[model samples]
Target: MTGNGRRGRRILAAAVVAAALAGVLSGCGGPDDVSTATGSTQPAATQPSATAPVAANPEGTNAPLPEGAAVAPSPTGEPAPEQCSNPTASLRPFPDGAPESPALDRIRARGRLVVGLDTGSNLFSFRDPITGSIEGFDADIAREVARDLLGDPNLAEFRILSSADRIPALQDRLVDVVVNTVTVNCERREQVDFSTVYFEAQQRILVAQGSGIHGVADLAGRRVCTVAGSTSLTHLQRAEPDAIVLTVPSWSDCLVVLQQGQVDAVSSDDSLLAGLASQDPYLQIVGDSLSPEPYGIGINKYDPDLVRLVNASLERMRQDGTWSRIYDRWLGILGPSPGPPVPHYQD
Candidate 1:
């Protein structure tokens, strides 16, 4: 064929191909018409509608607790009265004034009182998002101590401590005192001196709503979450020896596990559990007191004078109704206070 004839045929073929693609894009009924001009053989997948629920993996969260998790040691039995005061006992203020305490003198020399506590405790010592200050019932009590010691509530340096660090911090003198909701027990007294009972907490369990696990009785054979170095783990082990215990670094970690369904429930002091529940409405505290937890300010064993000063401050708080006011500020949701725990002075 001539060159012009060949060129004419090529143009005609190109026109025919363009026509075919138009037919496909226009949805003209034909065998190949189901395809689009872009050459896709199927409809473009539609994005999920705005109101459609997205699927999620409930287990797609932090890993589950490992096997052979650490358990808290059994509490050491009562100590000799001469070594430590009764956990329930506290001293009264001197008739004239707090006697000049060497520990108090050192704290005054430093200008800032150092306190150790968990910053994650919601109602007790968590940070306030708005004011950016760690404020709660425990924080208030610590501030009261600071005020009593240094004449200023703001002159306090809060050092965040893990459950495991409470005693070690005191022993190493890393902190002047620990105002974390430390429970005074026979075993703990051997390592550190504690103030008279400033607050009393009962052990309890927290579970997601409708979890079917109502209390410790239902915890057998199930996974329960608690913090490492916490008395709750020890109590749980004794109460349900067969239950699978999961230990986390913090109480907040236990809440995360329970919310993610990695554990059946989180067990700890009612006050701490209440703080967790306040964060998530779907979570609820169940069960009753597993045991009584008497909270005290932990100080170095060598600093009996500091312990006495803390006890005296607590006494003043109770006398002036400061304890009740602080309680109503953060923990009133739990109900009215039963009145400040009475001081029992061993001396």
Candidate 2:
């Protein structure tokens, strides 16, 4: 071969090699590029991804707020029931063993206790992905009630309810009772009867690690998220009037927005915030509790007899160590069992 031909061939081969290297570098993105492309550095095994397929909320977008959730709070519109010195004080339970009542008769006839609760409430009552069954602290509590009434812990039928639907479900007799984390107070007492306080929760803040938010005081002018129709929202609004409060339909939705950077932080009961934190190690619960929330089982107002029966069942759970067992199974993350809340009788 001629010298000129060899020199031209060498230059062309060198140019080709340089072009291929450029393409390879572009295909293998840098660390910043990977972070921006994925929108987060959180481990996929630990946290949900926006593009990942979720069994619930298939679209992967934040769940929509329930109807009327964005509107201003409305009055209950009926004559408020007489105020009680202790709203958590409930009817005295009947003696355990063969407890009978008219409401119990109706429920026994139905054969399955219809319990209302939100499945998206992690640690409280959420769908277990592996078993495809709803299981949590609150779910176990409902099962206990079913065991007492129907003699089989698995005989209860769970009805999914939004936070706002809790009172209406009881009033309309759609469910035998609500085992969701409902706060017992005077306003709800007028609408539905309550069992003794089951779990005591405290409102607090959840934020990404290194977030400037240390407490409610740091929330002013910052975007905060919580479930609509929740006492958490009311307390947050009262605590920081200037905060840009974002209300969603579920606590999971609050976690989604916070992860997506649509909100600065999430505020809710520490029990709930802990659940969110468990799903994402990047998140943390901060600050002292804002308020004490006494959770109770909600029943229809006319079913005073049923209330007595439920209170009786709760007492049995407390004495027999079932409450402690269930709490440890689901809520040991919150530290040692505090034991069950002491029952108070108005009678």
Number of clashing residue pairs in every model? 2, 0
Model 2 deviation from native, Cα RMSD in Å: 18.0
Candidate 2, backbone clash total:
0
Residue 15 lDDT (model 2): 47
lDDT of 1: 0.72
Cα misplacement distance, residue 293 of candidate 1 (Å): 0.6
TM-score of each: 0.76, 0.77
Window of ten residues with lowest summed lDDT in model 1: 28-37
Candidate of highest TM-score: 2
Worst lDDT run of 10 residues, candidate 2, spans 28-37
Model 2: per-residue Cα lDDT at residue 81: 50
- TM-score of predicted structure 2: 0.77
Model 2 lDDT tens row, 1-347: 56456445444543433232222112211111111001122311222222222121212354433222222222223443576688899998887554567788889998988898876689998877666677899999999999988899888788777686688878988888999999998888888999999999999999999999999988765667787678887778667654656556678878886887656899999999999999999999999898899999999999988998889889999999999999999999999999999988889
Off by over 4 Å in 1: 1-86
Q: Which one wins on lDDT?
A: 2
Q: Which stretches of candidate 2 lie over 4 Å from their true place?
A: 1-84, 96-100
Error of 2 at 221 (Å): 0.3
